[model samples]
Target: MPELPEVETVKRSLERLITGSAITDVNVLFPKVVKSHTPGDFKASLAGCKIKSLARRGKYLLVHLSGDKTLVIHLRMTGRLVYLEEKDDLPRYAHVIFYLEGGKRLVFADMRKFGHINLIPTAQLKNMPELKKLGPEPLGKEFTVQYLQQELRKRRTKIKALLLDQTFVAGLGNIYADEALHLAKIHPERTAQGLTGSEAAGLHHAIIKVLEQGIKNRGTSFSDYVDGEGNIGTNQYQLKAYQREGEPCSNCGTIIERKKVAGRSSFFCPQCQSSKR
Candidate 1:
């Protein structure tokens, strides 16, 4: 899945490419992809509206448009949103296409078909169930070390699982969760409340560090992710723990290992991230 950094990168790219451009038409090839309004209503709402700006909340991309409508897009897993010239052939998996006034196209493609687009009143965005329950952005001011400590102390869930909960930290997925835990030297199976003050601080810093680095690299492109300009990200090369199982640890000489934590594959160095609390 494209997490916070990938979605944020797409938001930045689309903001540059399509801001102020009017939507001439909208094509919903897969009607079910329109999760909120009917496909007809969705098309009518967006056509002729100018894209005011782009923003990302958690893993969701917000397309602020004229006429007070905002298109909230979630690129769940195996979803790709790319900007292309009208002269280019459409991608086979493109489920939604927005035709811009300047002979450009913004395409939303998903192989798994789990991606969704929701058109909602911008004023009601705060009350929208999808956006309402999301926790503070990891990079935002609200996600302080004290905040993380408090949240962690309140949960008995496995550290990895708690981090993956959108309502807990917002935007952490399997890859980044494992990376943050590895960086903080916290075992994935450890209970959330088991961490010491120093461990919580380390985890907080690790979360911010990895996310900033991911955005700097334009996000990890292990699968279907791409920026708005159709470029794959390079963060995959910088990964330390996510998919490096059996390799020597970047910090310690011990071999990295992988196991299921809360039903998700988690990678860590046994020597660096001890199971003891």
Candidate 2:
């Protein structure tokens, strides 16, 4: 699944490519992909509306339209939103295609068909159930070290599991969680409340650092993630712990190990991130 960095990369690329372009037509090849309204209404609402801007909330992409409506997209697992220079052949899994002015195309392709789109009044965006329940963005001002320390002090859940909780900290998935924990030298199975203030501070810094690096590298593209131009990211080559099981740790000579924590595979250096808690 695409996490914060991947989604943010797509949002930035789409903002550059599609803002100010008018949506002349919309074709919904898979009706189930339209979650907010019927496919017919979805198509009718978007016709001739200019794209105002693009924003991202957690893993959700927000396409602000001219008529006070927002197109919300969640690219679950294997979804890709590609912007084409011309009206070429539709990609194999293209489920939704938005025809822009001047013969351009914005295609939503999902190989697993689990991705979803919603159209809602822009005025009601903040109060929507999906946006309302999400926790603070890690890159935002609200996610300070003090805030992280306080949150960690209250949770008994394992640190890795807590980080993966969208309600605890938005946009962190399995890959980044493992990387952040490895950077902080904290065991994935360590209880959140067991972390000292210094450990929490280290974790806060590590989380922000890893996320920033992920964005700088344009997100880890081990699977289906790509920017709006369909360019694969280079971050996968920069991974230190995630999916590097049996590899040498960059910090220590110890071999990286993988363990299951909270039903997700977590990779860490046993020497650096000892399970002392």
Cα-based lDDT for every prediction: 0.92, 0.92
Model 2: how far residue 105 lies from native, Å: 0.8
What lDDT is reached at residue 252 by model 1? 80
lDDT of 1: 0.92
Model 2: lDDT to the true structure = 0.92
TM-score of 1: 0.98
Please write out the lDDT profile of model 1 over residues 1-277, one tens digit for every residue.
6999999999888788899999999999999999997778888888899999998899999999999989999999888898989788888799999999978999999999999999999999999998899999999999999999999899999999999999997899999999899999999999999999999999999999999999999999997888988888999999999999999998988999999989998999999999997
Cα error, residue 122 of model 2, in Å, equals: 0.6
Clashes of each: 0, 0
Tens-digit lDDT string for candidate 2 (134-222): 99999999999999999988999999999999988889999899989999999999999999999999999999999999999998899
- Weakest ten-residue segment in model 2 by summed lDDT: 84-93
Error of 2 at 275 (Å): 0.8
